[model samples]
Target: MGAPSTELQELIELLNSENPRIIQPACEYFSGLSGTVDGLNFIIAQEDIFKQLMKFCSFENSDIALLALKTITNCAQNENGTYFYMACDKQHFCTKSLFKSFENGDERIIKSSILLIENITRIEAGARHVHAFIEDSKLLESLLKIFVSNKPQYQDLSLIFGNICQVPGVRKLFLKNEGEIFNKMLPFLSHQNASCRLGAANCVKNCCFETDYHQWMLKDDSILAAILLPLAGAEELTDEENDSLPIDVQYLPSDKERESVSDIIVALVQALHKLCSTQMGRDALRKYNVYVILRELDKATIERDGNENMTFEIHNVIQILIGDDAAECDDLNKLEVPPEIEKKLTEMENA
Candidate 1:
């Protein structure tokens, strides 16, 4: 990085100016700059400007503060930008300002703050920082309070929860206390907004990675049913099959529809696949006749959008459900894979 350009220096001066007119437009200019890779790189190189923007997050003027946050949010969208926010002594500063923004009472500020934190938590190191931040600040309780309220305005908090739960320590919070917090998040899988649904679905999928909790999640929370409900259509099933299915997914209304977003569908399918890792999970899935739901979903998906990856995952779960367990290894989760096959799996995931 080189010295800041004269033009960049002038803009920084305007941003530092106490006048609302100067600072507002300067913040807007930085907003546009921070949105692109080249422009963000420029802003990142200018430590003074970057620090100024972080300070503006708490500006007395709501407009300036919101714009500064929006700019920071844009910068945090990429890995490099997220690292910049988490680097040096600014991590605590950045996270504290974000949590404070939650109480700003301005809808735009709150949403932007959530989005900024969401982007930060996407990176592994950033997630760790946020996990620690939440733990130390005791902010998880407050966040859960907002989440369980089911307030439409704060629906985007689901995204933050989803991303943060990717951390094992943070995930344990939801898993503990008999999964009290985890159960509250399950209803959002069927939220009216696709983003909320996607977030909650991803959260569920992340929690599914813990094999020990499989039986409890399936029985106590009805988690399998919550995830599967979004994948079921109005396709008719026989009375026997319907009765065998989990109640949440049985006897669909004629007007009932499946989740339209491909990503949510994929996440739900992956969660089901994770649940199949253990014997107990497999038994529960088999008991519920989950295959019946996936069979219809597979057909409907192929007919509508023909998402090959989605159908592939659906088929993968279907195979496990219908496989002869007696002839197969008892511990599916512990099965070893050959190097070539593992490499192929990695390539497929990357593709």
Candidate 2:
């Protein structure tokens, strides 16, 4: 693309002006220009403009920092702009600054940074670049610290970490920290915030995709109970049990929030289904009495059946958990030798 206009150049200069009054409007104007990919690409072509954004990303003024982040978030939304940002990010300076914002910037900056990182991770090249920076900076551990503190942004961090785990090598690293990650996430399984609970469930589902995690999960009854609690709804958690719950259980939903409530239920069930593959996992399901919860939920759905596929998935998981024939889960039993090869005639019978 051709050069950015003189007006764009003036606006870029104003972002660096001493006055926050000038910087805020300038950042807003740039963010507006970034509404379309072609507009963002044209702006990205202006290397000075891109570098200025990286500077303002760490502005002492919170409003400037947030606005700059918004502009970057808009740019990060386009794949071409994402590639350009990662490509032009020399010595990993921009990545480091962004993580710094996550660490110290106010709520707006933290949330915007999470969105920017999420947008970047959606592109494979961008994800790999982020993985490399995080590996060098020990950023995962830093995020884990923030998570342990239970900041409100922990919900965003959980979702961001879940997205990062989609990268293969990064997933392996997360698997190493599985215990700590699970310890933090499990409580959120019962969190009052619907988004927090949903993010936790999604992270649990992705982490459990590994065989090693499945083995660990099967052995942890506490986790098994925690995973089933949301799907089982209020009935599984008594008033006495709710009083001592790890987090305050959300009060039953009103009419307006019913859809959000349903979405969280689906997420929890999906996470449970990820656990039903192995015999050990199935045993754990029964040990935790997951079948009872799922059966009740399935029956309720059947009586009021609106969503067919979700009901089918929940039903399927219950069957696998309760099925008598091990062959029903043959896919999970594949490590063993085939029956014909393992079978041998007794010598006495042969005689």
Best by TM-score: 1
Clashing pairs in 1: none
- The alpha-carbon RMSD values of the candidates against the true structure, listed in the order shown, are 2.3, 9.8
Q: lDDT per residue, candidate 2, 1-351, as tens digits?
A: 454487766776796688888878877777777887677877777777777877788788887777777778888888877887887785778778878877674788777777788778766678788888888436687787786677777556666665666566665676665566556777876777666676677667766666557787666567766776566544444455444332323233332122236555676776777677666676666665677667767765655545655666677678777778465553463546566654542222233
Candidate 1, residues 249-321, lDDT tens digits: the string is 7788999988999989998999999998888888988989889989999988876555878877898899999
Candidate 1 residue runs with Cα over 4 Å from true position: 1-4, 88-91, 136-138, 303-306, 325-331
Best by lDDT: 1
**Model 2 misplaced regions, further than 4 Å:** 1-24, 35-48, 78-84, 103-105, 122-127, 136-138, 153-155, 235-263, 299-309, 322-351
Looking at candidate 1, the ten consecutive residues that score lowest on lDDT are 85-94
**189 Cα displacement, candidate 1 (Å):** 1.2
Clashing residue pair totals per candidate (backbone < 3 A): 0, 0
